[model samples]
Structures are given as structure tokens and as C-alpha cells.
Target: MYLLILGLLMALLKFLEFGFLAEVSWWWVLVPFGLAALWWVWADSSGYTKRKAAEKIEQKKRDRIEKHRESLGLHKRRH
Candidate 1:
């Protein structure tokens, strides 16, 4: 995400001919975007995306259960 954001910012700056970025080649300005794409590919292939999605789904399930218990006037028992 950070890489994506940075790449976009640099691209915008270069496009607008801002300061040092004005002298930068389009290829250089686009390097960050390429890097961001590579990072995403690596992350996806390594199962990071799947793990995070699973964790998010598990959290939602836990929240739903807790809300249902509360609505039914149930209390959590101590272990």
C-alpha cells in the first residue's frame, strides 16, 4: 500500500513537472509502480492475502456470536 501510494505521488509530481521530478525520466517515475506490482505478486503467492482474509472472516464471526449472545441476555463464563 505504501509503495502504491508513493508511486502514485511520484508519478503525479513527475507529470506536473514538479522540482527534481521534472528532470526524472518516465521510466524512473514508473519504477515504484513496477515494484509495488512485484510486491503484491509475491505477497499473493506467499499466502499473505489468504491468511489475512481468513482472519478477517473469523473476526466477523466472533463479533456476530458475541452480539447474538448479548441480545439473548447471556453472559460469558470465565474459563
Candidate 2:
């Protein structure tokens, strides 16, 4: 997935001339490249977003449980 995205980005960058999209006789090619770029960004960002969100939730739960245990002055002992 990453490879394909990188490839498309490279292609688009190569196609651009002087910081502008090259005027291609066939315009339809631009559509796929644009879509690919959008997909790549969305895919990359969503994974990190989900991971961070999950970590935040887990940490909150852990903190709450720890606070509860501390208030009770209880801990598990291994002997």
C-alpha cells in the first residue's frame, strides 16, 4: 500500500513542471493520481489516529484503576 502511494506521488512529482501540474493531453490520468494521494494521506493518518486514541483510552482506564486501588490502600502481593 505504501509502495503504491509512494510510486504515485513520485509519478505526480515527476509529471509536474516548475511547481505546476503538467498539462496532459489526456486529463483522466490526473484523477487517479489525485485519488491515490488522498488515499495515501487518509490511510496513513487514520492508522496513527486510531492508535493514539486507543492508547489514550487505555491509559485513562489504567489511571482510574490505579487511583481506585491507591485510595483503598490495596495491592497484590506475590510470595
Candidate 3:
């Protein structure tokens, strides 16, 4: 995600010929996107993406339970 964002920013800057970016080749401008693609491929093959998604869901569940607990004065709220 971060790499994709960086690639977009670089593309925008290159398209606008902003400063030094104007002199960079198209290949260089596209490197971040390529890296992002490669990262996605590796993550998917390794189950990294699924694990991260599961972790996020778990965190949301925990937050919701903590909020309910705090509302009911059942337990101390975590930071």
C-alpha cells in the first residue's frame, strides 16, 4: 500500500515535471509500482496478507469488546 502510494506520488511529480523528478527516466518512476506488485505477490504466496487481515479483524473485535466493557464498568479500558 505504501509502495503504491509512493509510486502514484512519483508518477504525479514526474508528469508535472516537478524539479529533479523531471529528469528521471520513466523506468525509475515506475520502480515503486513494480516493487509494490512484487510485494503483493510474495505476501499472497506466503499468507502474509491473510494473516494481516485476520489481525486487523481481531483488533477491531477486541476494541469493540473493550468499549462495551468500559461502558458497563466491567473492566479497566486498555490503552
Candidate 4:
């Protein structure tokens, strides 16, 4: 995501003839996008994305359970 944003910014700067960026090659300016795509491919193949998604779901479940427990006066609030 960061890489994609960086790539877009670089491309924009290059297109607009911004000072230093205008002097850079198109290949250099487009590298971040390639990196971002590679990152996505690696994350998907390594199950990183799936694990992160599962972690989010688990956190939501825990939060819901804690809320229910607190409502029932069975959970203590952290100081």
C-alpha cells in the first residue's frame, strides 16, 4: 500500500515535471509499483494476508466477548 502510494506520487511528480523527479527515468519512477505487486504476490503465497485477516476476526470476537462479560459484571476494567 505504501509502495503503491509512493509509486503514484512519483509518477505524478514525474508527469508534472517536478524538479528532481523529472530527471529520473521512468523505470526508477515505476519501481515502487512493481515492488508493491511483488509484495502482494508474496503475501498471498505465504499466507500472510490470510493470517492478518484471521487475526482481525479473532480480535473482533474477543472484543465482543469482553463487552458481553463486562455487561454481565463478570469482567474487570483494566486500570
Candidate 5:
């Protein structure tokens, strides 16, 4: 699916005969720019990073619980 759109873009660029391709000599710029834009969107708006942060907080709570139990000498406390 993505490949089709890419092919069409390249074909259009060729058809238009945009001379920027030759003067800029940075034909690969489009790929990196697209990737950076994607990364920014996904990293900023997605829940993946939020979930990871939540997991870290849960882990810290567990660690604090273990420390509290050790301090109170209740390592073998039953639930």
C-alpha cells in the first residue's frame, strides 16, 4: 500500500521535471523527513509511552511495599 503511493510520488516528480532534484542532490531527503514526522506524531500522541510510564510507577510502588515490609520485619506476612 505504502509502496504504491511512493511510486506515484516519484512518477509525478519525474513527470513534472522538477529541476530541484539535480541542484539539491538530496533526493533521499523525503524519506527521512517523512520518518521524522511519523516518529514525532507516534511518540507524542500515542499511548505506548504513557503505558510505559504507568508501568514504571507501578514497579516503584511494588519496590516501596517490599521495603516497608522489610523494615517492619514482616517479610513472611500472609495476605
Candidate 6:
């Protein structure tokens, strides 16, 4: 995400001929975008994305269950 944002900022700067970015090649300005793409491919193939998504879903489920229990006045007792 950061890489993409940075790349976009650089691209915009280059397009507007601002600062030193004005002299930079378009290919250089686009490097961050390429890196971001590679990172996404690696993360997806390594299951990192799926694991994070699964964890998020599990957390939501737990939160919903807790809310339901509270609504029913069914709280867990501390030992």
C-alpha cells in the first residue's frame, strides 16, 4: 500500500515537472508499483493474505457471539 502510494505520488510529481522528480525517468517512478505488485503476488501465493482474512472472519464471529451472549445476560464467570 505504501509502495503504491509513494509510486503514485512520484508519478504525479513527475507529471507536473516538480522538483528533482521532473528529471527522473518514468520507469524509475514506476518501480514502486512493480515492487508492490510483486509483494502482493508473493503474499498471496504464501497464504499470508488468506490467513489474515480467515483471522478477521474468526474475530468477527467471536465478537458477534459475545454480543449475543451479553444481550441474553449470559456472561462468563471469572474463576
Least accurate 10 contiguous residues by lDDT in model 5: 20-29
Misplaced by over 4 Å in model 2 are: 1-46, 75-79
lDDT of 2 by residue, 1-79 (tens): 5556655665576466423344433354446666667876886777965787889999999999988987898856569
Give all candidates' CA lDDT scores. 0.93, 0.67, 0.96, 0.97, 0.68, 0.96
Residue 15's lDDT in candidate 4: 100
Model 2 lDDT-worst window of ten:
17-26
lDDT of 5 by residue, 1-79 (tens): 3644674565466557665543443455256457656766786698777888999999999999999999999888678
lDDT score at residue 33, model 6, on the 0-100 scale: 98
Report the error of model 4 at residue 68, Å: 0.5
lDDT of 2: 0.67
Report clash pairs, candidate 5.
none
Residue 31, model 1: Cα distance from true site in angstroms: 1.7
lDDT per residue (tens digit) for residues 29-77 in model 3:
9999999999999999999999999999999999999889888999864
TM-score of 5: 0.47
Model 5: residues with Cα > 4 Å off, grouped in runs: 1-37, 77-79
TM-score of every candidate: 0.85, 0.39, 0.78, 0.94, 0.47, 0.89
Candidate 3 collision pairs = none
What would the per-residue lDDT of candidate 6 be over residues 32-60, giving only the tens digit for each residue? Answer: 99999999999999999999999999999
Q: Which candidate is the best by lDDT?
A: 4
What's model 5's lDDT at 5? 63
